[model samples]
Target: MPPSGPPTRPPTDDAGARADAYATAPLLNCLLREVAQPLDGTDEPRVYRLPSGERLLRVRGVRRPARPEVSVDGDWRPVGHAELVKLVAEELQAHTGLSNPELPAEMTDSRDAVAALLTARDGATSPEDPYRRSEQSLLTGHPYHPAPKARGGGPVARWLPYAPEAYAAFPLALLGVREDAVAEEGDVSALDAFGTAPPGYRLLPAHPWQLDLVGPGLTEAFADGRLIRLGTTTSDTWPTAAIRTLYAPEHDLFVKFSLDVRITNDVRRLWRHDLLSLRRTDSVVAAAAAALRTPGAWLSDRGYRTADFAFEELAVLVRDGLHDHLVPGATPLLAAALVEDFDGTLPAGLRDPDAWWTAYLGAVVPPALELFARSGVVVEAHLQNCVIAVDAAGTPVQALFRDAEGVKLLPEVSRAAGWERLVYCLVVNHLVEIAEALRESHPGLDPWPAVRGVFAHESHRLDLPEAAALLSAPTLPGKTNLLLRWTGANGADARYLPLWNPLAG
Candidate 1:
């Protein structure tokens, strides 16, 4: 076990205030983007006209808008998180002429979850390693989603122990599956080293939280002797930004499990179909990474293991760790953490904003485009799936992409559809967020020109005609998460609305 430390509690009032700030930004982002219109010709406090056009709203910050107020009786009255949920529900109903009772509860659950995480983090000690610190630092997640932090309305006690935001690390629950009932594909040999199993069984490591969620359902298997508990791993595994995936520093490996709770859009389970098709998708991405001219890597999802009786519920995937793929002496940082802000992740001080911006684009952009154009593999290069390795001087040296389950093949999807998805994931979701973050820090810097230059330069070398067209396109597609949630659409069903393209000049 890892060494333990004494717990210290931050004041309740301070924790609540921090939670409110973190929760409000994402809610306000949804309202402003999907339902509210900017009320032009205003100064100081920015104002917005609601969908009804009768009510007006105003907020205080630029990047993270706060202190929301609604106009009533010609006076502005502050709205709390509860009132904000109510207001969003009413506005969505008015705009779409459809109502969803579940989303409001989810919005409230998200805020309450944040409050719980803040309180837990007060008594917790952060990981000493910079990479682990970056992985766990997301307080307000998914800037555009309505309930990015919601954990399926589970009790705080049930989920808080595993939350990445609270700096959590715990040993994985090791189980022994009867040899006859074991189901596995590809290379899952890495799992065997975690713990020992009996002669007639194979070793299977499960996420403690996931096991907790599915424990009752597995009682029959345990009773019948098909599954046996084999204690926990000797070393501690820390949760990454994606909560279900845990990293064991000692082994230099990642183990992904089927988390039952809803995060962002979907119930984060390793669905049976995705697991069955994992090897093919991973192989294509691996091939693409090998062919890239730039220094980039792909962390392959090598294999998974589960019991035949509870395949989807008990499944766990093995992924490559950062050690082997990383450049010598380079430190790997989660790309999302770079945008969200974490200690020691960003450069000490960026002397030249333009050069810094160029380095970032150079490391992140080419690989995705190259994969799409050359190998017909569309890697999900979103912020969460990408890791940017920086040298000692804090310059981005290489880009590493992961999550094979999210990769799409060109022949599988129509060319036009694949291109759109690639553009959305790489440009709109990844680059736009990073650029805005850079602009927020360096107010005088205009990062878009460097972005335009990178795409233009790449267009001449790559065969993608879409790259040239993207340069002059009027708008880019932005995923409609707010509407998707409200309408109860499949999480993977991406529907986009036209967003003004910054690349278009």
Candidate 2:
């Protein structure tokens, strides 16, 4: 008899093809669920109900959307605005049962089109429809995100890729051109090196320099020697699709970027940090470098890794050797400085700075003692977005920050006139944000010793009460509703305060 076990079939071209298709499994699943099936073979596209209950369409001639074919710096031909609207509307009508009548009148209006379309598909009109809105809501209006309209009629500093129809939850943006001009057809790792692969992932080592060419708009900038190269790092430990790099030209310092767009439920760990209530926390950390007499400017590209390339791609460039000394581990201090008051309340095992387990607490403690009011602004201060550098003695000597993205600036202060906003941001929002992470990661960690360490390292005359006040105060929850008292896109008020000032009473 034949082998009792299952017989293995020889691998064929079809088998190889099946293996190749796995990379696009997510996209295929999307198409299959959203497109509909036809009763019989017909020349026209057919709508089918997927087993998952999603509507999908199978077009006879149309294939899956291929990776972008155009080269970097190529002339960009947009699908005209009118044509785009027609395409979107037609696609929705053909695939989903909803017709023009079912759509909100606002959808027909070009100004609110996207919003209206989302509402219609979301079943906002009826109570019974089960439509799961995409995750785009998480970041769409996030305070740290650049305003939709450019600040000065120019493109915002950051670039994000957005897919209106697919994975709308993922606020996609272009980082740069792919490293390769052509599809690999065999080994795609080469594409990754060339900037063709998604962010937060690295190509196989065999791939060459992974140089992604810059786009035309920034060509003159590079030709004039306005841009410089920066150093690169690839971290497999972090989420995929994140990249970080730093560059400095004659005057301005720049950071290369990308982010891991996936959302995790570990909200407390990443955002809503407790350390954002510290006093002059930004200055305290920045002062370390001044005291150490370190040279050059600093930028935060900590959220992502930076790739090294010969030329800029899609007009994006990463400079070399800019942040060589800056490393990841230093994050714990910056986080410590943000929150943790030394004097006020004593939780057991927290007061003694000299104790062994408590010794490191002094590293996170403050020197001055005073009752300092806390700010209410919540900050997404995590290890990934912070930087601290230490000296040979293991003393934290310097701090660097970057990635204004995810930064929550108090709307009132951001728009108002004064250094209060900046002070609140550097000290209250950014510096202390990292502190919350340290406290949470190390359960046995005490706030005072760490607070005292920061103050002692910075040469602050130890005043326990003031320092305690700074650390003990609870940072504002980062919820903006209290700041403006109004919600739902009515536009912001002229007076907005990012940091909560309860002392005003």
Candidate 3:
């Protein structure tokens, strides 16, 4: 891994183009999936009709749709991101017969945030290590999310310092919790190495952004000496794609904090209920990982600590780092980054796409299925949670999963529900994105055959009946993020729509 210098800023002319590209992708995704219906016999410039308002829309590309236009007054008019947001709002209001003042504002905030991120990224220095660079490179996140880049509608100054997209790394605020007021579970001993607390206190590292957000609420705790600020960490930790999680390179550890700001559907607080059940959830996944026949590993969420007074506001989770879980010589990269084309490190000149796709499916798929079938644990094997360790040749060799907070156990959810969730995460969300990237890069290559082959092979090994059904299923469940957010549904409440299954011949 070589040291990276600051990225050169693009000219003003190019900056706007880049920002539009970033902002419009998710908006178009939301529009196409939720409100617009594709027109028949369209290929070159894909066209759609917004059935609700009888408006015709057209765009150039597929994966990240661009050059949007809508037919108006007997002429096609180009819709900028702002106009697109407005169109989406109007269409949704008419289609659902429901009005939301907040979502439209969030749509604008998301666009503005993209523009700000573009400005910050210009002349910004990226992390030197490939893994760190991959983790920090997600500027246009959650391709199908309407407000993926929205930062709680905060001013740039408030959030930029902690933004992973800005290539940020900062020290955590170290706090001393009075021993009597410390609420902790499992192995939080790793925190003690950062700094020593006074005789009657325990060390608890806090994300500065979170502290800033909740500072006003904690005046009395600070005044009464239940919580003592012990200054910042001596070294800086890099913010990963999930902004709330920080990676301390020196310690090779990850710390997840409670953030009050909304990152997608949720306000990202480390809720007390989730924290209370963390140990049990993690133990189940860890045990399943330990029994894996392949090199797949689960980066365990070992423990967490927080002040009893503000448990959810101040809770911090300790997760095992990549170093220990990775195979002897493999370099780990965020799986989501591989799909996003970060650093363009994916190898070129591969004579066989089948081999590559097979290797990827081999590493990513079986573990999730095996865990579900054998251990009754449904790992959230989505791309962001999965870190694929690749060899020097950029071939995926192993898969490591994290985020115990998202894992669900058998009997908690019905077996049918568990299987549905697993297929959606593994096939729809994770593999489909990667497959599209591969197909886009290698235009002549059909990736589904390889995917189908892997499923057929794995079906014999795993006891999952859905594996067989998945092969010929006409549709798969696609999480309706746009509609879910628009309807103001609970973040955990998942509502899915049927998506055409590519695996079906």
Best by TM-score: 3
lDDT of 2 by residue, 367-453 (tens): 101101122222233333333343333344344433333333333234222223333443444434333334444455544444445
Error of 1 at 145 (Å): 0.6
Winning model by lDDT: 1
For model 3, residues 18-66, the per-residue Cα lDDT tens digits are 8778889878987898768888999979988895756889998888899
Give stretches of model 2 more than 4 Å off. 1-314, 320-323, 326-385, 389-398, 403-435, 441-444, 452-505
Instruction: Rank by lDDT, highest first.
Output: 1, 3, 2
TM-scores for every candidate against the unseen true structure: 0.96, 0.29, 0.97
The residue pairs that clash in candidate 1, if any, are none
Tens-digit per-residue lDDT, 419-495, candidate 1: 99999999988999888888878888888988998888888889678898999999998888998999899999999
Question: lDDT values of the candidates?
Answer: 0.87, 0.27, 0.86
- Winner of 1 and 2 under lDDT: 1
User: What does the lDDT come to for candidate 3?
Assistant: 0.86
